[model samples]
Target: MSRVINTLDVALVAAAVIAATSLLSNDYYLRIIFMMCVYYLCAVGMNVLVGYAGQKSLGQAGLFAAGAYAVALLTTKTEISPWWALVLAAVIAGLCGVLIALPSLRVKGPYLAMVTLAFGIVVEKLVGEWTEVFGGAQGIYGIRPISWNEQPLTTQQWVWFAVVLCAVAHVLIRNLLHGRFGRALLSLQADEIASSSVGVRVYRAKVIAFVVAAVTCGIAGALVAQQNQYINSDFITFHLSIFILLLVLFGGAGSMYGPLVGAIVLTAIDAALARWPSAQHFLYGFLLLFALYAMPGGVTGALQTCFKRKPKKQRLSTGETPKTTRIGPVASGDLLVVEGVTKAYGGVKPAQNVSFCLQRGHIHALIGPNGAGKSTMINMLTGVVAPTSGSIKFLGQEIADKPAHEICRMGMGRTFQNLRLFADLSVLDNVMLGHHTRMRNGFVSSLLGLPGALKQEAITQARALELLELVGLSHLCEHPAGSLSYGLQRRVELARALATEPQLLLLDEPAAGLNPQETAELGQLLLRIGQCGVSILMVEHHMDLVMSVSDHVIVLDYGTKIAEGKPVEVQANPRVIEAYLGVDDEPDASEIHATA
Candidate 1:
């Protein structure tokens, strides 16, 4: 499917270029095409940040201005040629992007948008006021165009270069988004907590995405400046940023061909409305409203909806023999050790002085009533929540202060009590994301679609399919994870977590929404996984499953450990019975038997 789309896109771009250059004689229409090329570049870059990473940036014009000014100033003030200026433009803009991304790490949604919007306004005002370097509101004129054979290039020649640049940028962006980096971005978009739990460095990936977007915008800005031979403060504004954003949203933010198609259509609309300048804004507002109402997924998404494919009759292959699937070698003792761990929120402690050791190749169950701190202890071990006091050692190393992703990379994988599957992504994609840390490819390798990255991707895909088969959802591997039943989603989440191939698996209510049969199957699956040398630490309410599977059990009540023993021993303890049912009330025989 993806190959077909890529071929179609290449054919469309080639056909459009040939038709526009040969059929259109009017310079006005030709100029519009040139501007569309520039907008295509901006929209493609913005799509990466907005569509792929799911970060909102309303200040792309600021980055755009930085690029334009870089080229304009360097060529005018120094000995640098336009070519050198263009390169510097991208670097400068990418640096500016880092400035915004740094602050964005602390904010999201509208707050982040406001930050970028303020940046765009500031850039515009600074350029308008700074007369010495920027030429103030008057701006710079007579900037040299790109040259070939030591001869200054014309606008027509510049337009061809712009088209070529857009094509190259599109291919690179597509490759980057389809490979490991793209998968990480999609995971970040779905759920940052889940993404981190799978060993993805969420903030770092976002920053890299913004930098890529900024470089592309910078390239577009440079192209526009050279083509016009003039650049002024009014050209790059907050309004321009909004226009670019509209193009991305209206064209389908995440689709490979959406941005370019949107650029062509919107640019033409703007040109047609040039005679009635007042109506342009009104029409744009109307089009945005219509797009939201009629085509929520944008044009490309709508087209996909119109041409959706039928489900394939396929099943996951399952001929391989099971073997020890090891993440890394562990010390010959407890896989995890927690001592005197405490967590507090404003004098209220949800977990206090919790201590437990999970031996290697054993299933250790942590059980407690609601709000008994089982979840908190699990969070602390996984590094999702920090301990206010005490220590946590995993694989013979102290990881009390490590980040969640670092802990994950250190051979810990966990599932959420509330399902955290990437709702918009496919079952296979969700599982493939588990191997993110295992992948060794760099951004350039991913963008170039190198043999190494492609090979790694294939291996991950086959492994993910095997995981889906293990969980008995192999037939639904291509379906969206969110569309599955709650039980199925849980299984998918487990498959995704297992993709990490952790030495220790942390299952938080793994059988939460499952029926008796499903729960039994899950128990059998866990035992199978444990046989592969993986240790399990589970927090479960299903006493039958816990008692049947756990080698050891720790009981918690009111934020502290009350009993620790084998399941039967813990069940027989008076304190455990008192914690579940008050001393005045006798424990039910069936309930006691359930724990045995």
Candidate 2:
């Protein structure tokens, strides 16, 4: 029923846009509508880059120019039909986008913007100066118009075609962004580090976004080439790129239909202000500033908020059949080995020659006072930080210098001490990312909602739901991770880590902010996890919980391992006591035992 309503809404919108064209039959008004369609198409592409991938590209005009010239050069110099030339223009521009994205994506923020800016200027100058290839500053002239049935299309016919093309672009963008690939892009935008930890290849996602945006802008340029029936270097410039970006931003970067709304409103405003030419630029800048200040989420976001729909009540379900899937190779001995692992920043060592072994299907705890490098050791083991010396092995394979995502794919999952959840994503989505490594479907399959991808997605979702239930957070699965309380967020993070179905779980400071009651609950949770044949290694400061759950314990002080044994033995070790409480007031075995 909801899908039916959404489909009806879309149909109504498309019909309205098409109907507007008929209502305004004047050639001038129709021409304005055509320009809006072109801008809307380009804006949608910009939205993919700026809104989805969180990339700032100032080279959209270069892509637009490439498309326009491809059309112009092909139609005039060769005998290619205008339609074929437009298709070629999109291909040429998309390739150029790939070139720019490869290098630009390596850097981020202002550096990336500068790279794109330079590319746009270079393309503009090339078109202006390359006399033979691009017809120099004058550009190509007498470019043939796009035609149907071997006859040049009239203005009205061309306007309808542009509208249809814009509609198609909208459908494609909406479909592409309504799946797993879209969530991955949003995750990339929210937090690159967290996204990578969940097995997202940040570089590849960004490049794909750049390519998509470039193609759309290129197509828009081709449409413009058809409309003008001529081309010039002056039309494609850095200012045009800025205008395109502004359109996406003002309309709402992340919202579907935001580009359309932004394009129409901005173009109409600019056209209206044309009579007052002197103040037009100032008014435009002012309006942009005002919109940003008033609605950080953009026009679409503001409208959504004003007309926000009440989320349906989601019931929490605790009962489910447990799943049994081994995360790594079945082994009978120790699951992990760390030998002479040393991590140093300059001359200071946070972890010095740390040696430990995690027996399979057991709970091992690392406990130490502040500055004991417990978190650092966890980082080294999980591939978040590289060990300066010595070897670390997991599942009988050395994994000292591997990247975080690779290690995760190899069956090591971990939660951060500082809580690195995707704040903008729902709790369920955050957990879903942990299953990304296990997913087999391609992006194309996900976008098209193929049966295989849908089946896998459903399985992943059910598994995530089970994990959330295990963590006692099934009720908050749809909530934004950031909105949860600190203690609750910790549970959500744990659920996400478990979603990877890890053979070894590395939990850092899981009890940091929990109350005594919550701490007790966490201890039971860990015990249940261990019963499932998953090995547990945790860095914690909560002594009572650690003593209650840990089968074996390692004590660290000043980056050095002082003791390793049963929890009771570690508690009574003289060196561990002295390191924790100070040499002047060391506790005896009996006193330590009593305290425990």
Candidate 3:
């Protein structure tokens, strides 16, 4: 139903634009409309990078020039059709995006912005200096415009063409951003570590976002070059890149309609300020600062907030039975094996020669005092921290050196000791992101909104809801995960981990901040998960909860395992008791057990 409304809204806007264009005969107004369409194309893609993926890019002009220059050179130097040159230009720009994105892998925030800014400066200088290929300041002329029925389109026709392109771009982007891919980008922006733990390939996702932004900006530039039948270094400027970014920021960076709103309003402002050429830059700078400080969400976000309706209450229901199939590669022996695992930080050893075996379908607990390396073991197992020396295997696959996302894909799921929820996302969206690796839809299918992709999205949402029910958070599914109570956020994180459907679940201090009642409930939840054939390795400090729920207990002291046995047996070990209670002349075993 919401999808239908969104489609209708877009259709109405498109129809309105076409009607307005038909009535306007002035060339100036028509050109303004055309430029709006071009800028909108740029902003729509930019939003994916800056807003959703949280990548800071200030070099969009370089990508735009890539397309503009590609079209210019291809049409003048070769026998390529204007239409074919347009497509090739977009491809060239996407390649440029890949180049700029390489810097993002090593830097972030202001450093990334500087790298992109340098890229724009370099492109600007190259076009100005390279007269042989780019034609330099004199510019290239006689570029052929796109035509219908073998004749070049008229001025009004160009306006119509750009308007149609804008509509198409909006719809395609909306489709692409409404599913798992969208959620993955949002998750990537929220927390890369948490995103990877849920099986999102962090670097790949970043590159995809950069490419998306570049392709659209490239298309915009190609359209401009073709329509004007000219191109030059003057067309590519640092100011243009800033203007493109301003469109996303002032219109609402994350909102679907943000680009359209931004393009229309800012383009009009640009035209009005044309009379005061010197003041245009000043006003634009002011607007950027204002948007960053006073209107971070932009005009669309502010409008939505004003008219936002209360979310309907959701009722809890008995969750459907979870799938019974074991969620990992078939293996005949123990589910996991760790031998001689050691992790050292300079002179400090957080983990040393740790060896353990987790049998199929049992709950094992790792308990230790502060600095005893319980959490470090969890990190090593999940591939977040590489072991200095070790062998770690899960379901017969060596995973000690794998990337975090790859380890997650191999049927290992975990919760962080510190809550890592995608705070701005709803509880349901958070869980649905965990299914990203399992979904079969490809990028093209998602972008085009194919039936299979839509079907998978629906199925994933239903399954996510079921997980919320299982965690007693069904009624709060629509609430932001960050807005929930501390205990509720923990549950949301658990449900998200469960969405990965792991055969081996590694939980790091799952009950860290929960009250006694919540801790007890978490114990029951762990037991229930174990009954479903999922083996558990939990790092916990709550002795009572650990003793009650864990099938085997391992005690660590000063980064080394000191005891391993049944909970009762570990409780009776003098080393375990001394570690917990400290060395004393007469330490009571029962007192140590109670204190632990």
Candidate 4:
């Protein structure tokens, strides 16, 4: 029934667009709409890298020019069909993207921006100076109209042509933005090392993002050239790239409708504001300043913020109803097995020949002196850093080489020593990102709001809120995660990790910087989580909390284990005492007696 409704909805949209195309006949309005479509196409390309992939490229104009020139030369100077020229243009531009993206892999920030800027200048100059091939600064002219069935298209026909192609591009981008590709891009955007550690294919994701952006630019260029029937070096200027970037940014970089929104806003403004010869710079600058202050999230982001909602609390039944109903099978036996693990950076060793195992429902403590390699051991086990040597078996499988995402999928999740929440997003948004990892919806299915995606999103929202409530962070759900107090941020990070429903959770310094009361609360929270069958490996300096909560303790100093047993056994060991005091220092023989 739902699928049938969706099919009907799509048919209605197709019919509406066909009808609207027939009605929009004014040349000025048609041109505005066409330019909006073109800009939308360009912004979508930019979004693949800028928004989704977290790459900053100021060189899109170079790719756009390469594409335009490819088509211009093919149609005007050669015998290739315009359709074939479009295809070749996309390929050429996409290859150019591959070339630029290679160097980009090694550089970021100002360095990357300069690299792309230089590339754009080179492309523009070559097109102008290479007269034999490009017809010099004047550019090749007399390109034929886009023809299908050998019929030259009219202006009205071309407007509709632009509309159809841009619509197709939008649909494709929407799908790509929500699927495996989208997740890969977003993951890399957040943390490259973490993404790679999680099996995201970082290098491949970067190249693919660049290629997709280039292809979209090529298509937009072809449409623009065909619509104008005249081309020049000026058509693909460096300013054009900057303009497209600003447009996407102003429309909400994360949204599919962002490009369309940006295109309409800017095209209308530019066309209207162009008539004031001397006031152009001042007017445009003022507009940008206003946008920066008033709508920094861009149109879609602002809208999302305004419309954001909390998961509604269920009205309790008349009798015995509870909030949580654990539906999945609980983990059994040992949840995580660590055997003979060692890690070294350069000549510095962190963990040496350490072994431990965590049961399904216990808090395992990893404690040590400042340099004991406690954090280093966690890094190795979680795949943040490769171990010098060792094996990690989780949930009955050898998971030593698994990526972080795969580790997460295999029921092992982790929190960093330093909180790494998506700071710019709301607390709820941050949790939603974690929920994204658990979802099974494809990109295509998500955009169509497939029955599965809708149901899954609702469940994810409910679960996320429930986890937030457990962490005592439910009230701050609408606030930006970064804006929260330090204690609150840590809990939010924990809530995010919990959203993945891990069987084994590795927490590094979770109690760091918390007040005594907060620490006590956290201790209780850990106990409650343990009762729910999630195993824990905690690295903490909060001795009171550690001694009170952990079922088993592992002590280390100078990158080597000094003792392993129950908390009391580890606390009483003389080797642990000596490791803490160093070789020459006598254990205060009096306090040592009490410790014993």
Best by lDDT: 3
Cα lDDT of model 1 by residue, 1-596, tens digit: 46347846875886578556766667786788789988999999999998889898888998998889888888877888888889999999999999989987689888988988888898888888887878877889878767999997655666667777887788778878887899899888889999999999999999998999899998889888877788988887776887888888899978888898789999999999889977887877777786668887789999999999856756754644444454435545877888999999988898889888889878889998888998888898898999999989998899999999999988899999899989989989999999888888888888876778778888889888877776677789888889889888998998888889899999998999899998998898888778767789899988889889999999988899999989888877888887776674667635754442
Per TM-score, the best of the predicted structures is 3
Which runs in model 1 stand beyond 4 Å of their true positions? Answer: 1-12, 15-25, 316-331, 584-590, 593-596
> Whole-model lDDT, candidate 2?
0.83
Taking all chains together, each candidate's TM-score versus the true structure is 0.95, 0.92, 0.97, 0.79
Worst 10 residues of 1 by lDDT: 319-328
lDDT of each: 0.85, 0.83, 0.89, 0.76
Q: Which wins on lDDT, candidate 3 or candidate 4?
A: 3
The better candidate by TM-score, 1 or 2, is 1
* Comparison by lDDT, 1 against 3, better one: 3
Model 1 clash pairs are none
What does candidate 4 score on TM? 0.79
Ranking by lDDT: 3, 1, 2, 4
lDDT of 3 by residue, 1-596 (tens): 56667777888888888888988899999999999999999999999999899998999999999999899889999999899999999999999999999976589889989999999999999998999888899888989888999999888899888888888888888888999889999998899999999999999999999999999999999999999999999999999999999999999999988988999999999999999977999988999999999999999999998999766777754555434433444444688999999999999999999998998868999998888999999999998999999899988889999998998888899999999999999999999998888888989999988889988999889888877777788889888899989999999999899888788888999999999999998898887777666788999988889889999999899999999999999987888888888875446666764675
Question: How does model 3 score by TM-score?
Answer: 0.97
Model 2 has a clash total of 0
